[model samples]
Target: MGSLALKDLTEKCTTKYKKISVTKDIILLKNYCHEIANKSLQILEVNLNNVESFKNISEATLALTILINRKRVGDVQYLKLNNYTLPQAVNEEHIILTESERALSKNFKRVVTIGKGSKAVPILIFSGCDKLKIF
Candidate 1:
């Protein structure tokens, strides 16, 4: 594939993604994904394929840079899937997107606490992913 402007790439991705039931919050994810796909040799490098059952949000964010930055700096390798279930509730979990909870609130399976002290924020809540990475 040839090099593409981020805007153009984002537009293309928007067009493609519109066909799916994917939520609008994932626009960030899609824009990043398209940027990575256009700029890298490995098409799937910046996709959610790196997400694993035990992976944390921070680690996944780092992986996404390789997947969406449009600069190929990392080796592309497929991650194995692990079956897991979503938790009903987890304390101190962070939900970055304000409205994410509404869409996936019922599907949470795990949580991660963030920042200083025990009183810190719950920075991440995740749904079970057997073989998918959704940024």
Candidate 2:
């Protein structure tokens, strides 16, 4: 009887899993992140219209952290940040920076203020998918 009960439970779980779709899961996750991003922006005194911006930043930061923690050397990742600048709080200690690249024609240099001090470090900032590559 115990074996029969276990089999029935397994079947129910399988059916429930089959009903779940990847697209739906992704949408749910994006919505959840949007909510959190909005709250974070409010705390930072950022405009409400920039909720999506914050979400993308959070996602990219997570991706970078995962790649660095995994020690995946030589793996290059790209992030797109159209016009959004890196927050003044981000520094080399926050995210591991290997290198950065840009054409000579560009006016803005990728740099971020570090810590409580006034010093700045070169940083490649990316938002959605415009022109930021991470190595």
Candidate 3:
């Protein structure tokens, strides 16, 4: 998935669930699944044999979300899904506002832009928590 899509998904999750804390790594994994889905869509046009890959990706994404919720409540120490160990955190930065994303929030206020030239796409802005906000 592109950075913009990842950012949008991350924002969506964080904003929608105000009580739950979402980490950067989880967002990255979600984006990876999204990319897989995108690839699967492309592959579907060529061959139906790739359908199983799409199913697996969907299952993995669901499992990851479940594990995250478990971890959030201090019920798990490590995230292990599909026989793979996921790091609690990633060193890479996940939040970087693009020009278009920045335009969605003017003067630190969330605004929805619509229609025509120079209009910003609507986006949710998360603040207060450093982990939630894209810098």
What are the TM-scores, per candidate, against the unseen true structure? 0.25, 0.26, 0.28
Runs in model 2 with CA error above 4 Å?
Answer: 1-21, 46-135
Clashing pairs in 3: none
Best-matching candidate per TM-score: 3
For candidate 1, lDDT tens digit of each residue in 29-117? 75654455343323345554644422444344444433333323322122112311234443454455457665666554332323233
> What lDDT, from 0 to 1, does candidate 3 have?
0.44
Model 3, C-alpha of 46: deviation from truth (Å): 1.9
Q: What is the Cα-based lDDT of residue 100 in candidate 2? A: 52
Global CA lDDT of candidate 1, please?
A: 0.40
Compose the digit string of candidate 3's lDDT tens values, residues 1-135: 999999999999888844554587768876775576556556655786776765754554444434433323212212223212222232232246667755643323232333235443322222221121111
- Report backbone clashes per prediction: 10, 5, 0
Quantify all predictions' global Cα lDDT against the true fold: 0.40, 0.44, 0.44
TM-score of 1: 0.25
